[model samples]
Target: MPYSNESHFHPATFILLGIPDLENIYSWLSVPFFIMYVMAVLGNGAMLLIIQTEQRLHTPMYYFLAMLAFTDLVLSSCIMPKLLSIFWFSSTVIYFEACLFQMFMIHTFTSVESGVLLAMAFDRYVAICNPLRYALVLTNPIILWMGIANVIRGVIIVIPCPGMASRLPYCVTNVIHHSYCDHMAVVKLACVDTTVNSVYGLTVVLLVIVFDVIFISVSYAMILRTVYNLPSKAARSKAINTCTAHICIILLFYTLGLFSFLTHRVGHSVAPYVHILLANYYLLVPPVMNPIVYGIKTKEIREKAFKVFYKKV
Candidate 1:
């Protein structure tokens, strides 16, 4: 539907409803979410600091991991502060421009995270499948280029989404069902036909996330095949063990991510509370869990983390 008139074409501000169907308990919910946010920031921040300071971690694998940690930190920060404010102080009204900026930051960081994961998969692929040439294959210059490419790819692809959504005539309602400005949630509020917005959002998800998942899977598949061909049982065990953290991260990130994506379209049957909760968790979980996963599973990170604590104590 087009706007009833040009006078009704724009909304000056939007209000974010923290979670649908749970307004009474929003404060209680904030406790756990606040904890998760703290953990995400501290954990990822520590990992970034360690990787930067520790000369021993000056390799491609840790380099990629640092990139992932940085993305997680920014990603969690982008959503959680605003969300917490909504729940605690009831600060829900956001300017239209600020909402668009938040939408862009959330989506861009998410896409960047996917790209970083793909880069990590490639790092592991070379390390496992082409160990002898790993150093030569992933030179400092190459790793720097990979990081730059991931940032550029996400930024270039996501710049248009907020513009597309923002240009829509949100003449109907300004209350978003989500805690933060979600692209679909915001666009669907527009009185105008949002087919283009929906299609463009889906296309970007497919191109950035689905495409990255496919290539990461291929890289891991090749790594698996190479590992299987190794004659030594110990070598096979070591190879798979090295991948355990990344594999867990991939599963955690994409599984929740895909579920959240599907629920946006096909989740009418589900309770709004459940859908909103899942969506928040989808963003919060990876950032909080990734650093813990690396700390527990990766020997180098774990060792450095322990040593840092030991020295402090």
Candidate 2:
């Protein structure tokens, strides 16, 4: 809140670097980003539409997928428009409050997605290991509470992020060498020591991403045992098939997340551009890929999506 005595004025703006070292070719890069953005939107939108209108999709798995689609839609929409604007129009200026708000939204949605994946893992575990009680285990009331708990956890944990960063006196540079206002990237620009922010960031990741990954892994371990013990190959194959889409999603989401986390922490070994690029990929890839993966791997949703479209024509 207070400016450094040296500057005598609190900084009020931050500049987001669209993509470091690529300003000369931002126009060239915009094409693919634009295409991915459009595809993510349309694909996720279609997934939501079909899941909403199709009666057969009114199940726990599809319900979680719908939540995933909605999260992706929000996640992509929050970042890409500003990123594209920066790339094309060179509109890199972001107000201090706006930057913090963007950071909050990004982190919040990320946590929500992680929680959703964990929910899906549990959904599979119940359906596979306790088929008779699947309905009772993951009823609408339980699912709704899981969703609410995920969101509340995100909000309560992430509140300190922007607050910590904003309270620091940014005396020198306000230029963030990243496309959007990420927690780490923004806090690094502060002239004061950022150990608190850094530690808090790491803690958040450990609690949300790492903890979820471990839980999902354990759930799938149990799932594999259950499926393997099935008396018939048909039953085993059927169970595994049902989990395929969720498995792909979990792999994509966490792999990119861990990579980005590592790159941010120890990426000094590589080019800064490499870190920057991976950071962008870490955020963008899941949103673009999740819908495509689900659309292809999950048969019912895919067929229903086709039906939904065909009816319009």
lDDT of 2 by residue, 110-159 (tens): 99999999999999999999999998999999999989998999898888
State the local distance difference test value for candidate 1. Answer: 0.90
Question: Model 2: number of clashes?
Answer: 0
**Candidate 2 colliding pairs:** none
- Between which residue pairs do clashes occur in model 1? none
**How much is the lDDT of residue 17 in candidate 2?**
79
Candidate 1 versus truth, CA RMSD in Å, comes to: 2.3
Top of the candidates by TM-score: 1
The model with the greatest lDDT is 1
Can you give the lDDT of residue 47 in candidate 1?
A: 97
Worst 10 residues of 2 by lDDT: 1-10
Which regions of candidate 2 deviate over 4 angstroms?
A: 1-9
